[model samples]
Target: MRVVMFGYQTWGHRTLQALLDSEHDVVLVVTHPRSEHAYEKIWSDSVADLATEHGIPVLIRNRPDDDELLQHLKDADPDIIVANNWRTWIPPHIFNLPRHGTLNIHDSLLPKYAGFSPLIWALINNEPEVGVTAHLMDDELDAGDIVLQQAIPVSPTDTATDLFHRTVDLITPVTTGALALIAAGHTQFTRQDRTQATFFHKRSAEDIRINWDWPAHDLERLIRAQSHPYPAAYTFHKGNRLEILAATVSQNRYGGTPGRIFYRENDGIVIVTGHDARTGNNHGLALTRVRTHTGQELPATEYFTTMGGYLTRRP
Candidate 1:
């Protein structure tokens, strides 16, 4: 089948690579233009690079509403259009261009983490299982008919980066399998249950700040969710920002104050919880790895010593 592929970021990159490896013919690839601003430095290779390497025509557009994009879509005349992590909401006309209709590969199971940063939100919210779904693209974001879905286990130690890689691995196989089924006309698509749907917003820097007052389990989830690749959950230590990369729930129940650095152990730093004795659980959180304001990543032991044990708070 002739295909028009739309994607961005690493997820998009993986999808494009899969299509190249598959039996289907990718006629054109569409990707967002590279952004080189102070806040957008995380941007990586353009999907066009892969398409160009494969000798396929490539189109770069910031938004799907562009008139040029509409013209390009008409010119491509693809049999199927597959969108993977395409940031923009595609216009209806583009979705209606192909005969088989456009298929979208969403990171989370449909009707769940629909909007953006699904993987991050899943870990932050302590979801036990994460999955990918291939669905028919609709006007509503990720509110489409499901073509295929597969689940992946999320370990207690898994970070957003870890889940991201796992999800990608899960998605590639399911996506390729779905495409092959579609090409063979052997699959039936089911509409999503709108009542079961939930969407998450794009995670911002403000969301990365660690809230010490939250329950130890919740804080632990957040720490793992944002660890490495994604920014680590941060807290203020002696007016300096400390990024907590890894942490474990402390088995000990000694607690006077939340966010209080009780003591430093060889394994990590044990901090007390600030919950009221009558109502809140007095569990401590152990800090394993942390990043200092100097942009240095160090173990909690090294960090506490380097700061001259300044994290202690007045009782």
Candidate 2:
């Protein structure tokens, strides 16, 4: 079958690679252009680069609704349109072009965590599992009927990066399987239950701010979730922004203001986190590794010789 693939970022790059490896002919690839900014880190292997390497026609456009792009799609006459990590809203005319319509690959299980940065969000929330969802594209964002979904357990020690690689490894199988199902005249789709639907907003600079008032366990989860590759969870120490690389829930109970450092040791920096309602006292979050604004990564012991200062809160 002739296929038109729309994708961006690392997820898109991997999906396109899988499609190229499969039996179907990829007629064209649509991907967003690299940003012109110097400081912005490109997290994924470039989809456009990958497509170009395979000698496939690549369209670098931000909006899929452009008249020229739509005309190009019509000219290609694709049997199916496969989308993965393609940001921006794809208009119905564009999505409905192919004979089999558009199928999308989403990072999370649909009806939950249906927006950006899904893996990071899942880790922060302490979700038990995370996986991919290949579904038929409808008018609603990620509300499409599910063609296939397979979950993997979220390990306690799994960071966002760890889960990302695990999920990426599954995309080839899931995508190929979904395509196989569609090609075999199996067009059935399981309707998602609307009652349990949840959508999250795109992450921002503000989302990485570590709130000391949160419970110790949640804070520990946040640190691991946002650790390296993604932005590290941070708080202001002295006059500089301090990025926390690793942390754990401190067993010791302490009494102090939520943001204040209550105890310091070579192993960890035990700071008061939140009020423990059961004990009517404050709990602790221990920071094991951190990097200061000076670009120096160090253990908690080296970072702080003296404690008992309140961490600055910034919006």
- lDDT to native, each model: 0.79, 0.86
Residues 1-315, candidate 2, lDDT per residue (tens digit)?
A: 899999988899889999999999999999987764221244668988988888999999988878889888999999999999888899999888898999999989888989788988999999999999999999999999999998899988999889988999889999999999999999778999978788887777788898888888888989888867777889998768998999887776776678787687448999788744245375688889989888899998788889878776662
Off by over 4 Å in 1: 36-45, 274-280, 305-315
TM per prediction: 0.90, 0.95
Clashes of each: 3, 0
Candidate maximizing lDDT: 2
Which digits, one per residue and each the tens of the lDDT, describe model 1 over residues 1-315? 989999987778888888988888898899888765322334354687888988998888778888887788788889999998888788888997899889999999778889888888888788889999999887888987898999898887888878777888875788788888888896577889999888987787778787666777888888888766666778878888878888887776654556667766558787765455234356667788988889998888877764223232221
What TM-score would candidate 1 get against the native? 0.90
